[model samples]
Target: MSQGKLSPRQKMINLMYLIFIAMLALNMSKEVLSAFGLLEKKITNANVATSERNVAFMESLSTMALEQPEQYAAVKRKADQVSEISATLDAYLGDIKRQMMTTLKAEDFEDFEVQDQPDFLDQR
Candidate 1:
C-alpha cells in the first residue's frame, strides 16, 4: 500500500503477469513453428511434383525421338543435357539440405509441426 513497497498481493500479481507473458511467448513460438512446418511441407510437395513432371517430360521427349529420329533428334539431345544439369543441381541442393538437417540434428522434417525443439525458433 506504500509508494516505496509492493504489498504481498502486488508481488504475487507481478509474478503472475510475468508468468503470463512467458506462456504467451511459448504459445507464439509454437504457432510460428507450425507455420514454418506447413511451409516446408508445401515446398517439399512442390519439389516432388516438379521432379516427377521433369522425368515425365524427358521420357516423352525420348519417345518422340525414337518415334521420329529425324524430327526429334535435337529434342532428345536437349533433353539429355537438361537431365544432366538437373541431376547436378539436385545433388548440390541435397547437400545443402543435409547440412541444414545436421545442424538441426533432425532426422527428417515431419509433415506436422511438433512443439519440441523450441530452440529452432531462435535459429533466425
Candidate 2:
C-alpha cells in the first residue's frame, strides 16, 4: 500500500525502520566512529596524565614538608591553584575535542596523517 494510505501500525513500523536505518548509518560511518574513538582516547589520556602529574606533585610536597617547612604552605597554596587551572584547562580541551569531532566530515579523517612539521604555535 502507498505510504499515504498506511494504517497506524504501518506508520509506526515505518518510523521504527527509519530510526533503525539512521542508527545503522551512524554505525557504518567510519569517520563518525573514528572521531568518537579519537576524542575518547584523548580524554582518557588527559585524565591519566593529570593523575600522574598530581601524584608526583604530592610526593614533592611531602618531601618539601620535611626539608623546607616554611615554604611548604606556599607550595601547597600554589599547588591548589595549579590544580584548579589544570581542571579548567582539561574542561576546555574536552570541549574543543568534542567540537572538532562533531565538525569533522568524512573526508577529514580519510588520510589521518600528521603534518610533516607540527604546528608548535597552535599548542597555546
Model 1 lDDT, residue 87, Cα: 94
Q: For residues 95-123, could you state the per-residue lDDT of candidate 1 as single tens digits?
A: 87665555453444563345355453357
- What lDDT tens digits, residue by residue, belong to model 2 across residues 5-33? 87899889989999999998755454655
Instruction: Give the best candidate by lDDT.
Output: 1
TM-score of 1: 0.57
Candidate 2 clashes between residue pairs 3 or more apart in a chain or in different chains: none
Best candidate (score: TM-score): 1
Q: Give me the runs in candidate 1 sitting further than 4 Å from their true place.
A: 1-33, 107-124
Judged by lDDT against the true structure, how good is candidate 1?
Answer: 0.77
Q: Per-prediction TM-score, please?
A: 0.57, 0.38
lDDT (Cα atoms) of all candidates against the true structure: 0.77, 0.70
